[model samples]
Target: MLINDNQEQIAIATYGLTKIYERNIAVNEVDLQIKQGEVYGLIGPNGAGKTTLIRMLATAEEPTKGEIYLNGDRLLQDDTNPHLKQYLGYLPDDFPLYDDLNVIDYLDYFARLYKLSKPLRKQRLQEVLETVNLENKRNSPIATLSRGMKQRLSLARTIIHQPIILLLDEPVSGLDPIARLEFRQAIKLLQQAGMTILISSHVLSDLAELCTSIGIMELGCLVENSSLDNLYQKFSKQQILISTLGEYDKLEQQLKNCPLIEHWEKLSQKNHYLAHFTGNLEDASELLKQLIKADIPLHNFHCEKENLETIFLNLGHQQTS
Candidate 1:
């Protein structure tokens, strides 16, 4: 983690970032500040400039106009700063791997590219292998590894240099559920180890579960940027699901009398009811108490916060509106 004299821990910062290619403005003016050790999720539809923004941050491409600062040091336009290279790691959506090399050899190749010394390179290789849960397959040939294993190997290669910040683009694109879970766990471990990560994923549920904060981009513009909680509050409506024992009619009647509920509906001809509720948790609890006092015979009740997918769609609608 890096901190300046003001005691602010910022891992990456960009101001008025923009990218232009002939007639296309791939990325408009964007300002972002990511704190140290925060797992930030970048969400948006296809061709939303998510990849362009990531590429600029990774130093893989130059921004048309903007200032980029990593750990408080201004990045050069040429992006040839050797010192900055050690602080940033980038894993693109399609990671190229050497099928001929064994797992250890492949990782060793990248470590050498990073100019790590012999002892430190060997230690980092071991650490990264363990971090990605590939220690047992260190001797296995890359060609024989599964897709999930290959993805993990790519991540190991990215982190072998132990960079402080990582930029990942759709890392779990083609993985199965189990593979996605395993990869997510690996990312969480990296976050715990104090690496700030900016990851873009189409998997909204996964992002909701893993990211502490999120930024939503739309058509080369950043429309939303905030913590996950704040995003939910801004874009989600609070709802509650209630299931009654056998008294559906009674439950519906009692809930209709409650002032906290803005609207209520019986779901799909089922006995379960969902209500759009307005109020804090205490108010919700009081409503539950009222239902119990009225003998509504509740079997189950739970509050539902909007998921990432729902919030994303709402943002999309807002964009067009």
Candidate 2:
């Protein structure tokens, strides 16, 4: 069933998506659909076939089996499909470049490849250069630019055609902290431009920061598919941190006595403890009330949501064990 059917905000779709290599199943049977104008994330551990999946979606490589639709048109088959090439842009994890060409020359050359006319080509070149903040280096040779610059240049080329859908494979993989931040800002610009983006990254924090919807793959299965917020809620372990005025020894004993307190540990000082309460938050609250009534000083307490790394680790562990 096509969940996104007739939705004006739909971009990519795959039915029974599969890619095989002889006896090895690179990507197992999968179903994926992404809405337009959202930063969707394809997250997985190393060699989880995220790259291969993105490649198939980009129309660069054919899938062993299954079908992909871009902008509601089946990919790479019909030239007359109005929703074909014009609706797509793909940026690989490792962007290739022409070392001999300068920045402006490089972008202009790609514009011509996308069949833009003379005046339109210049306009697009200028727009993309500014978009990626490469106008200052417009005359610089591609070989002279930094890795970050190269990534930005590659992005400029990807958007030179003004593609409506973008399949980016680890677009921010190799960059310094400042460069990564700049790259993130560039992505935000793309998002505001209303580009349908599918970004694949092994970096959990970066993905967590940029993506709104996410799909997690492992062992050739789409183990999870939902909005990032929902995934966090579904898999997250809720806990709380607290600091008391009195020593935590009494509190530690209280913690051990409560069956509802699944796990907890003392913090740096004698009066603080980071507590993990899995079963019932209200029961944990009742325990806290009892502690307060018993003269166990309660200074501060706040809920702590599990971070994306913890979610990933827990998922990976569940899949294995």
Taking the tens digit of each residue's C-alpha lDDT, what string does model 1 give over 1-321?
447456879888889999999999989999988888889999999999999999998888899999888988887756468788789889999879999999999999999999999999989999999999999999999999999999999999999999999999999998999999999999999988889999999998899888999999998988899999888877788889998877777788777888878889989858789998887888889888988887877888899876889889977997899
With candidate 2 superimposed using the best TM-score fit, by how many Å does residue 12's alpha carbon deviate from the native?
0.5
Best model per lDDT: 1
lDDT of 2 by residue, 1-321 (tens): 234646454678888888888888888988988887889998888778888898888777778889888766677644566458677788887667999999998888889888999988988888888889988999999999998889989899999999988888988886888778778888989999888889988778888898889999997777888999999889888787888888567888888887777889887786778877775667667877888877887888777788888898888998999
Judged by lDDT against the true structure, how good is candidate 2? 0.83
For candidate 1, the TM-score is: 0.90
lDDT scores of the candidates, listed in order:
0.90, 0.83
The residue-level lDDT of candidate 2 at 38 comes to 83
Model 1 lDDT vs. the true structure?
A: 0.90
